[model samples]
Target chain A: MIQQLNDSTSEAIQQLNDSTKMFNLYLKLGFEHLLDLAAYDHLLFVIALTVVYQLAEWKKLLILVTAFTIGHSITLALAVLDVIQFPATIIEWLIPITILLTAAYNLWTLSATDGDSATQKTDLNIKYFAALFFGLIHGMGFSNFLKSALMPGEEQQIVWQLLAFNLGIEMGQLVIVGMVVLINFLVLNFLKVNKQNWIKIVNTLVMVFCIWIIGGLLE
Target chain B: MIFFLQILSLWLAHDIHLTKAQVDVNTSEQSVQVSMHIFLDDLEKVIQEETGFTEKMHLGTEKEVPEGDSLLAVYLRSHFLITANEEPLSFSFVGKENSQDLLAVWCYFEFPLSDISTKKLTLTNNVLMELYNDQQNIITLVGPNKKRDYLLFQVDEATASFSY
Candidate 1:
């Protein structure tokens, strides 16, 4: 009876260890997905979304990113659940297109618009909505990565894995946003770069990169 | 502009480097089956580097190399290993198929076991670890009596064992 009790206790500990390891593994995978240079479309989108804002607007930035995360989370779950399916190539192509549009929007707002407070409010609302919608497309791209990594007969643990993976991605995005904000602060304050000029420069560069990606996809 | 061009050139030649494997042990059949998912381009590049195969393998394409399977088998035998009860077990390459996107291939392998009960099972999967520093190999092993184990293999750590 003593041996039996010991055995059960060891088994329980083993089970807990296995679960914790699994969670950490998925979380790392999700974080690495954003940081992976080969899969830079997601990284590009985050940068484009971020360059338009200043460090003072972190609260609004947080909400905008969360909206995007919520949007992608829904579609990511749907795609992983096998409820919706699309060609991987199409999703890959669409990712760069989203980045291109976002960059263009940034350029237009910076250069073309004389922003009164009311118009700026409406513009911010529009930006939030666009982030959410583009996030849906990005979610499909993420689903391809998760689906390829998923193991057969591991459906029971899918929920936990998905949650951990999404959390990791969110954390990774915030890190990128933080770095961009810090750079903006340093360049504007120390280097004395004009905020408007800086935003325009970054957006223009992003647009050029997006075009190159889209052009490659077309070929 | 120069920095952008350099990054563009780098991006053109690279894709995510990840491989996944599933190991299923059947107590009733006294057999173990392993399936691995690998990118075709990465496989070709690695094979070229390891085996001195200069020709384009065009793996997963209509004009695939005739000796692609044999080359792949040799590579797998050298890189991936399975051991049962502290004794190394040999596996035969069963078959392979193109993944849905055709960007990757799933290779199947089988290991016949003499004893149904295995006290310890160890796997060493270092496939593509040498080529890419960021390469990751995910293994999901299902042992006897429906016991499951999962491991992520990186360049530094490539071996894992399960004790039943």
Candidate 2:
């Protein structure tokens, strides 16, 4: 007769090592997904999301990024597990549309007074949830690669991998957002470019890119 | 966004072109580490079918499946057989890992030894064969001298002998 193979002691000891491996593998996958040239749609979307925020407002940026992470993880888990299957076609189209909308929002709100602390507070509340909401659609866009790369495992294990991968994506997005903020600081603070003009220039470029994507998708 | 990739995985998995498993031997440690990776959905179906267990076993959660681990171990032992110097060797269950990249769960197993005076072994891996007619299990055996031998096991012929 075969003895009990999995000892509790061994299981306890191996948990840390096993979890570390899990984090490294999924984290790498998540980071690479955002950086992939094929997933330029994703890269551009994240850029559009963060283009308006400056690095000095690190606290607000962190919250906004977290909200986006939460939103994507929900749909990513739902879609990949086959619990909520929407036609991937619709998602593909909507991803570009979403980017267009976000860039347009920046243009529409460009003149909103950032100097007023009260207005800034209210604006943040809106943008925080906005990132969360749009992030759901981006999650769908992210699902295919995620589905292909993930190895289906136990239910608990799948959840952990999903979280780990999402964390990885967030890390990549943070890096991109960081660079954007840093560049804006240098251009506005050091280079002495007009803050308003700088914001307009960046958002205009983002808007143009979004329209190009939408045009291609429609064709 | 392209549909071809999704369909491709399905056909390939069914055609025995993509599902994979691996193992590596450590001669100095007098041991071997085994990892078998299988799709979660596919694995769940097979486990449910073979054991006739009604409840689904969640990978990392506390969802209880009484005897799930034991049943899993039995199935693993039966499908994955190891021999040293023509003598049967039992495996000690290590642990398991789930990879989102592979959409598969990897269960770990190992065998301990005192020393490696000789390195000749046999391995039999037939995991997921019943469900996947095209399943392939790849075994890589390493010796103390850093030498390596490989075997690609297929349906109906799932065992290989290696000399290091």
Candidate 3:
């Protein structure tokens, strides 16, 4: 009992001392979310969204990407702030499905625009809107992670830590975009690869990735 | 550029995670052994909050609490309670072992009467509830050979009743 008394005394002191470790920890977690190859769901979603757009459409791409960012960020904040309870097992299953749906929609949009420049504008608009909703689901998926990392952190501090984490996720995402753009430039511009062939190859790979993830999750 | 990226990631996947408690009732021994596994870092954080301890409390580095107390034991005693057949069963701290892989540890506690012969047990586990709103505690009860039961405890729900 005497030993127990001392332990609690010290711990109470530590709580009064606020530290920056939590901030740095959350920031790193945000970056890990995007880059962890062990779980490529987030990476695949970003790739599928950006594969069709050229660097020339930078403004449009920025708008679409920002929409996704805002959508997920809101849910992540809600999860951390409100502590909204939900079943994580169900959320885990939905994440892979989200990737599958996003990839399928990409393939559908590609076929819709087949050799037609006129319909491209309409297709792009729908994609932008879809990105926002997809962001919400992705945000919930992200929330499962935030939930695990939320404890022992001050409720108020989490707000700032979450922002840091979101910023890290976005940074990791930008790196992925650079890689995608680089590959696109190399394959289409230098290798003289056909645009159709490139589209088919990348989309097919992502589709297979989706199936692989789904298969693993089911097991 | 990608090298810089790789350095940023893979630093450590030492993520904040859940806890697991295994309860085994040895009919012959007349006692139940509860082995609770929790992340060392997280446990320390929660401990720091409840107590005013500012020292770096790592595993195997046991020191008297500033007020001369056993931090782990005291914390566990308050949040983890067990009642058998609707009667409360007290837990006595036994020992703990830490795995070198980050801050995960297996903490041992005991209930003197676990000769669970057709009896019921209800456990209230709020181990990390105050620190983490989504703290998850998994409890598994194992018998001599073939019987196994499990209970999941979340923040909102902290009690699980078991009969076997």
Candidate 4:
């Protein structure tokens, strides 16, 4: 009886250790996936999202990003579980298209008059929805990476992995959003760049980069 | 300057540097089987740099160099190590196949053991570590009775142990 008890105890301990390691592994992968400079498509999207808002609007920005996090986590879970299917190539093509649309929207807002309160409200609402929808597309892109890491016959542990990976992505997203806000603050306050000019410059750059990426995809 | 160029080129070439290895312990067979999935581009670059072969390896294609297999085997022999009960177990390279997506290739190997039912196993996997600072190798071990364990190895810590 004592031997059986000891065996169960050790087995429980081993299971706990295994879970902790799995959590850390996926978390790190998800974090690094977003932060990877080599693939800056996601980074560019986050920056494009942030540049439209001033430093004071970080709270609102955070809410929008959280919505994105929630949005992606849903599809990431669904896609990996085989509840949904999309071609990997098409998903890759769509990722940059999202960035291009966000940048183009920024340009459109810039062209509009700055002080229309009703337009601002409508724009904010549209942006929230856009961020969430874009996240679903991005989540599919993430599933490709996560699927590559998965082992066959280990579907049971995916819940823990998905949770950890989504959290890691959120954490990485925050770092990027924070840095852009900081840079925007510094450029506006210290360098004395006009707010409209800042938005135009950054959005234009993002648009140009996306065009290049799209061109490469076409080639 | 050289280091900066290397880092820049690696960044420009690929988005992620990661590999997955599945190690299966077969008690009845008294052997361990390993299947590793690695990016084709990364493997080719590493082999070329290590072996001083400048030509493209063209792995998984009809034009694949005949020397590709031997070069890859040499790299694995040095970078991936497995031991049971502190006794080194040598593995034979069986073969490789390209993933359906063609983004990566799966390499197969086997380590024959006298008896693997109750032995402590340690693995040292440093594949592609010398090239990418953020290179990660994820190993999943399937033991007897379908018991499973997952391990993550990076440049700083690249060895993991298991017992069954």
Best by DockQ: 1
Candidate 2 DockQ category? incorrect
True contacts kept of 2: 0.00
Q: TM-scores, in order shown?
A: 0.82, 0.55, 0.55, 0.82
Residue pairs with backbone atoms closer than 3 Å in model 1 (clashes):
none
Residue-level lDDT tens digits of model 2 in A95-156: 77777777777777777756577877777788888889988988876676566544433355
Candidate 3 lDDT over residue span A167-188, tens digit each: 8888888888878877887888
Question: In model 3, how large is the Cα lDDT of residue B134?
Answer: 53
Residues B28-60 of candidate 1: C-alpha lDDT, one tens digit per residue: 878889899998878988988999989999777
Native A-B contacts reproduced, model 3: 0.03
Interface RMSD of 2: 10.1
Reproduced native contacts, each prediction: 0.31, 0.00, 0.03, 0.31
DockQ of each: 0.27, 0.04, 0.04, 0.26
Model 4, B59-105: lDDT tens per residue? Answer: 87778999888888888888899988888898789999988756679
Predicted candidate 4 versus true structure: per-residue lDDT over A1-219, tens digit per residue: 999999999889878876887788889888988987767788899999888776678688988898788778888989988899877677778999999999999889885637588888888888899999999999998887788788766689988888888888888998998899889989999999998999999999999999988876665
Q: Ranking by lDDT, best first?
A: 4, 1, 3, 2
Count clashes in each candidate, considering only residues at least 3 apart in sequence or on different chains.
0, 18, 23, 0
Query: Where is model 4 more than 4 Å wrong at Cα?
Result: A111-113, B1-16, B24-33, B52-68, B82-91, B98-103, B110-124, B129-134, B141-149, B154-164
lDDT of each: 0.84, 0.69, 0.72, 0.84
Q: What is the interface RMSD of candidate 1, in Å?
A: 4.6
Candidate 3 lDDT over residue span B117-149, tens digit each: 646778899998898665667666665432455
